[model samples]
Target: MADDSKSGGDLEKDQRSQEDAPPSSIYLISYPKIVFLYPTFLVAVVVAIFMSIAGESAQIGGNREHMAEVMSLIFLGVFGLNLTVLAFDFPRTTSLTLFFLGAALFMGAWMLLRFNPDIVPTITGLLKGLRPWANSQMYWLFASILGLIFIGVAISVRFDYWEVKGNELLHHHGFLSDLERFAAPNLKIDKEISDIFEYLLLRSGRLVLHPRNQPRAIVLDNVPFISRKEKQITRMLGALQVQVRPDNH
Candidate 1:
């Protein structure tokens, strides 16, 4: 069966060629996906700066308590926006229950205020008791630390991160260049978008890579465009498997 022998030889040749071929794609994992925290931190810095400037005004001394109250409200509102799915998403029944509860409270408050105008002064007094102010040193410190952490993360990502190639996964780390490799083909991958606010910020989430025979899985968080990465890895691994599958001779 010369024909059969020739086909077998050709298949072996193709396998050799495919093995020698360069990787179809390479992925470098980095840490800039934590972009959402920047906006709020930057806003906090601005608020701190505003307080310092306004502190110099003659009217500011007299109204320091008022500024403190306003600052607290602003911080509360902005920070509340960061609650992600914890706030926006709820079970259908749960949402309806909360809606009804809120409606009832609003109606009760409306009726009370309508009949008892004296409550307005009491509510104002309660609000005026809250004084929250960030001193200049505190805001500057907050902004500085955040800036430093971001910079350090950037540099660390540039040098110490993970890489995916056509055949293997690479973990690049350390100043002295410690490196490890794991089989990428047949790698199990899981992607998670646990936080909706995070998804809205950068289309990012967590990617878990389960390499064969490895006791522990690798989880990379704040990965940007994670869905795209997962698809690319799937296609790459699928192609790799097809190319390497055993054929009956």
Candidate 2:
């Protein structure tokens, strides 16, 4: 009986040790909020506004020939708006924004130079003439548009949020009372070092589980600061002793 009791106690100790053992692996998953360089957006906005004012002035000056240039300036203003949004890391929408902005700038600049030689010299001089007020309208437009762009960019940054703990993924977006939740299950991560845009843009990528039985994949793009997040998620998954697999879909 004593021998049996000793054996029982040893079994209990073994069980406790097994329970206390450190986890084998962990996977941490997170998506960092996109941050924009305010100065770049500011510069774009300033240029856009200058163009808009120049266009508007041409329209008012009864230079019917300058109407095309006026329209081009308006297109540039729209492009500036789209660029500001892209700077905030809206990858899914960036291509669309770029397309429209490029089209408008191209057409507008072409028409302005083609239609009105006299105004072209004046506007060109304003841009290149070195006079403080040469492109004064353009400068004012640029400053105003930049101010609006910053406001929108600030709102995007302030409202976006993301974090992960254990098996749960959390996201908060939009203004107050408009929140969203996403559960990242079977979380799979892939890390690569490649030029998104010659290092001007760096992209960290992620693939998350759909949490449904159906064979599907949820992809997260342009995630910045990925390594730290990878370590954290790995640790958490290890602690939970959950199996993670590559989601190829």
Question: What is the TM-score of each predicted model, taking all chains together?
Answer: 0.62, 0.37
lDDT by residue for model 1 (1-249), tens: 999999999999999988755456656464654456676677678877876786522133554445644664686566665543334643444655875797799789868766776779787566556666555566678778878888888777776788788678999898888899998877999988776556666677788889988999998887888887888778788778998999989
Off by over 4 Å in 2: 1-39, 42-144, 157-160, 173-185, 191-195, 202-215, 242-249
Best by lDDT: 1
Please give the TM-score that candidate 2 achieves against the real structure: 0.37
Say which candidate scores most in TM-score.
1
Off by over 4 Å in 1: 1-36, 48-72, 80-117, 120-123, 135-138, 242-249
Q: Report model 1's TM-score to 2 decimal places.
A: 0.62
Per-candidate clashes, comma-separated: 0, 14
Q: 167-222 in candidate 2: lDDT tens per residue?
A: 56555566773654445455555554232331244335443435434355545544
Write down the RMSD of candidate 2 (Cα, Å). Answer: 14.5
Residue 79 in candidate 1 has what lDDT? Answer: 64
